[model samples]
Target: MGSRRQFIKTVSASGAGLVAASAMGVMQEASAHPTSVWGGDIYSGPHEMVKNSKILSIKNPDGTETLGVVTPKGVIDVRAVAKKMKISAPLTLDQLLQEGNAAGFNKVVASADKSGVPYLDESKITYGRLFKNPGKIICVGLNYRQHADEVGMARPAVPPLFNKYNNSLAAHNCVLEIPPPEISYKLDYETELLIVVGKRMRNVPEAEALNYVAGYCTSNDFSSRDLQLELPSGQWMIGKTLDQYAPIGPYFVTSDLVGDPNNLKIQTWVNGEMRQNSNTSDFIHNTQHMLSYISKYWALEPGDIVFTGTPQGVILGMPKDKQVWLKKGDKVVSYVEKLGELKFTLG
Candidate 1:
């Protein structure tokens, strides 16, 4: 596992640089069309984005990441195949959805699958953050019935909302550095289903909410209990949005492939031992309800993500004397039925 210093250096040198470049690209695109609004021309719509496919973010040697399509043959590097075929395609997943280029992206995937070229070896490639900079990172707290009971809190009548900034985003198989003991020693894991919105929505009905989602992924809402519960004025944002605290993906399975988002099996294992084993059926506020509720207050844009609350069996649920927080070097794997497992280690 990489140390804290190494993680910071990598983010500063590579990740931050990529963010700046991506921002520039977005600015240029927006400048070309001044009349566009947040959910207007900026969003491409769900029809183009929600195809039945698994998408991967492959890190390039040049400190940038591109989209990779997972196929039966192997992982198709979209950038490599597009270059060889002399065709136009979006370079990154963010660009694919933001620019509404899924048709072009699909064309690249279809061509690469039939070209007979040897695709990338999945085991050999480095994974990148599936989302670099989503407009919003909304989270629902205490939405699970059993989880609320375990934590000695009443089931909330409505979904309690919170937010995490882009800084907390991390990729699959990434190693996160635990804060020093003096800062926070009581680290906990909360595995939950993540919702990726494909279309722009405001005041959307619950019946039409699922239609707006682009896809789903397994995500760990890693938390620091001391910073969350023991701090003055309850610093949920500080406790929840730590660097690399939200590690999502191994793949982003489209909504068509992951039908009935609220009924999937979700689980978490720490050091290969089962910690959370429950289905999304236990959710106090189901997927569509949460989406509809949030949309009433603000517009849900393409690339915005929502983390549904976790089920019971977290370290925080145990009695004070029996609680055992996550330590450095511990491996945690989060799994959802259709979405693949997301693994990360504490540094």
Candidate 2:
């Protein structure tokens, strides 16, 4: 990548950031969700595992590891269904690897297939803690060229990384209180793909980075640009951490089924109009290299999230004459493949 200061200087209005760098020779192309046009014929249509689903804590005779996924019409008591026909719920991939758990998971899914639950109207479901991640939340900025230009930031020699506290998490249906009137005037939204770590790992190699990832989801890395740019030292968290800035997820689909994470289409919608649209293929530094680099300093675990980065078309991307910062009554949706759409309204 290019230096943040030196980056925008190189691109006129057309943004040279995407074409300026090439890390994944062919660019691994996978949609954040199966429904994306990026990879046609990739999804197995609409499966029950996703679409109108909710996970919950349940219990049975075998002790625990009992979990249920609520579908559109009702709950699919996975364990209940499995035991009726001799099956089990898989707690980890190890269960799949061990053979026993895989048998049980298959049986449970088979039973669910027979349930009479109707298709869920996604718009009606109540969002939960998408992924109860007990791990660190990591983010990369200016990973997209257009994002760099809007802020007049040069690209970095590597990924422009940062962090946000878990305290900032918001679900798909909550309301974000506009930062206190005393703060910023330029509140913005960043739609990006979120990588959930599936297993514990440290000193991981780029070659094996994908294995450490559990799955993918969507996140709106909301920013108060004025507060973000307030300090001359450019400390991101100041602007990044003002309450309710991160809105993420509708579901957490297993990564094994997600295929490639780098190639998904990322979309952000304000109110009902599309604003930010781009593919992960444009990430100046892709996921594989990012996980490898960060693993050098931090030990990632089963729940850590790596927000790859936002694509072009944010509020900041517009010319000064056309920019309109977000405000109350605004509804924003950030979506990735399989992860579904994360929708929130501002009050």
Candidate 3:
């Protein structure tokens, strides 16, 4: 498979329309959707992708992942249930959203629930990366008021934007291997709200931004402070996008269920101690503003994700004398209201 950079280069070299048509053809062949259109268009207005659902990505023994839906009974393996019932369904969450197969997926979920199908216990199943290959992983820096105050940096007139590569993507409960100490050891945990875009957005208005969101998930923006801030000019991307540095998931709760994304409570814990306790209400630039602002510059597409920004209480916020950076064997847990807890260990 081609790298995201290479894919972008190809999309740039060739017009977006042509590339999109080709991709749509591939998706049509694999899923139930015949056209690329999933949600409403800009003229028709935005709409949420999934509703009242908690989605999961289950890792298979053969190194593949399948889509699962959380039901009162248990977690329904979409692929297994679809196969047994001879129903057409998207095999993975990525395919479901990216290929405009939400209708098919919803059908599978509804049918599975009423068909007396056997479902697997979520606790016993191995989790996979909720998002495997998002087109973009945009991040907002210093959007939280307390975090900016703690870092002693003036709040920007506009939201600061940075990015991470797909390689940094990790699953909940996965182990992250820290880089060698010679590389730098000032590792920190950043608990933040994550937004998953469900529809295409370009110059979207603040009032309608939430309509384009598919759902929200618990995510940690793990950072290597030395590489991010101590470098010559500061290497924000390099420090933020390391192997398995961005661990998200446990569950992807739909937008309707989450209600107001900007009013949610978010927190982080190191071992058993709470290190950060704040709410998205402290955002200098809330979810609406961030999405509307970003849409002004770049078109946000389906399956793309954005990290809203972490709050105060990071190690960098503490005075130099009291600073004790995170080390190997440390366990970090991130939580956002309505979104499940995301836990990982340093190896």
Deviation in angstroms for 295 in model 2?
0.2
| Global Cα RMSD, each model | 12.2, 19.7, 9.2
lDDT of each: 0.89, 0.67, 0.88
Enumerate clash totals for all models, in the order shown: 0, 13, 0
Q: Which regions of candidate 1 deviate over 4 angstroms?
A: 1-47, 114-117
lDDT of 3 by residue, 1-347 (tens): 46988998987878977889999888887566333332222112123376788998999999988888988889999878777776666777666666656666778887886666788999899999998888999999998999999999999889999999999999999999999999979999999899999989999999999889989999999999999999999999989999998999988899989999989999899999999999999999999999999999999998899998999999999999998899999999999999989999999
Task: For candidate 1, write residues 277-297 as lDDT tens digits.
Answer: 999999999999999999999
Best by lDDT: 1
Worst 10 residues of 3 by lDDT: 38-47
lDDT of 2 by residue, 157-186 (tens): 798778998778766677888776577778
Residue 153's lDDT within candidate 1 is 99
Error of 2 at 16 (Å): 70
